[model samples]
Target: MTGYLPVVGAAMSITEYDQHRDWILEKQRDLELQDFITADVLNGNWEHLAEEVLAKLDGYTGRLGIHGPFWNLDISAADPEIRQIVQKRLDQGLDVCRKLKATHMVVHSPYTTWDQHNLDQYDQGHSFKLQCIQENLGAVVAKAEDIGCTLMIENIEDVDPSIRVELVKSFNSNAIAVSLDTGHAYYAHGSTGAPPVDYYVKAAGPLLQHVHLQDADGYADRHWAIGDGTLQWPALFNALQKYTNHPRLILELANNANLPKSMRYLSEQGLAQ
Candidate 1:
């Protein structure tokens, strides 16, 4: 785990099961990847497609992970009923993970209408609203564990690290963990290296399950090629390597985390195994 880095996998091509089956399997073996990532919807033959891919990987003993659906999912909803609906959407990916025997489920904790950026707009009930949001997220964590799958909280650039840290602390579930993103973390802070990736790594160390690797201009998520921009891969890897579990790296390049470009960049940078 320390010496050799794992090959990265792509999100399913075009959300189709049949089209991606052969390619995913081939990538798994050819690239020596135990981890395959997908942002595929839970419906529309996703399960069957996953089965086909898993069957192929079963030959090579590959592990699977999923990027849960993002549309309309509100894990931090202030309303209890709305939060339940969001939980169902997230559970879809977890359920599929069970069928495919996926090792982890990567998820996004995105913005709500009452975005924290607009905190000044809050009236007298701001404190109460924030409490509701936290409680619902905690509940989601419990529900994720009940279903017997790991829920990796995806990182976002704009949200405060304290929010993520608090969620991890309060959720306190074995199934709950983090899906750190290098680019997102970089852009999340207002200034370059203001809150270093190393800081978040240590804070979320216990919940660290996997990672999304990319580079950006520190203002937007450009998803640049490795080392093409300013992302510090060597230092990032150095910090990550200090951890006990060798977290799988997902080369989250543009469109999809394609293996071809990922391999090329890593090879050029002497990062390929």
Candidate 2:
């Protein structure tokens, strides 16, 4: 805390954001709007939602981002038809970002535990996956670049962290970067035999630009408050100090009411302001 006071942010829906708008605007904390992560919202009258967000967020100044549509949309689909659908969904998400003036969008990683065990079993297996990613997301990445949005690839069931780092690097664009979800990493550590959460920070290093700072019991993605779970916050912060990128540490809790409790815990621990 002496050398750096990490900026703490939160991920919430429009309703939740409005409920806590006072606290959020008072501090001008970085925010990741979660309302654009589903198909229903993406297909519905999202323009109205954008207008509402813009009106509510008026006079507030902080880093704004959104959780892009990810449900049932795989960015590495091998089928051309499926890839087109995926591309459409993601492009729709970018449209939301464009309307909201969001600078970042969280996207789920395509790598899974199965890929870790079997990706190298065949010749050019990993390379083929990369090709599929390029085919599916090439245009989307270009669009993101135009809209001044960075796509953060978040780990879900990934066991090998370096695999995503490699994927982010493959695009070779500033709009593509790494996003670490703490609870997911902890689940991978305890349930999927992945390395500890701190290892993920070290692995991503400077490429890491966003973080979902939820707590878990190392068994599942609990999304609990900070002190309520078994994650090592100090170790995670220590590892984060190695890079000067100052990644956005967002508290992506399941219950937004517990945001105050989580902030209190981090403040008490001196991990974040």
Candidate closest to the true structure, highest lDDT: 2
Give the Cα lDDT of each candidate. Answer: 0.61, 0.92
lDDT of 2 by residue, 1-273 (tens): 557888798999877777888878877899999988878888899899999999888887999999999888888899989988899899999999999999999999998889889989999999999999989989999999999999999999999888889999999999999999999999999999999999999999999999999999999999998999999999999999888999988999989889999999999988888
lDDT of model 2, residue 265? 94
Evaluated at residue 10, the lDDT of candidate 1 is 47
Q: For candidate 1, what's the RMSD?
A: 5.0
- TM-score to true structure, per model: 0.74, 0.98
Model 1 regions lying over 4 Å from their true place: 1-46, 111-140, 190-194, 255-258, 267-272
RMSD for each of the candidates? 5.0, 0.9
Off by over 4 Å in 2: none
Angstrom error of the Cα, residue 254, model 2: value is 0.7
Model 2 lDDT-worst window of ten? 1-10
Error of 2 at 40 (Å): 1.9
Predicted structure 2: lDDT: 0.92
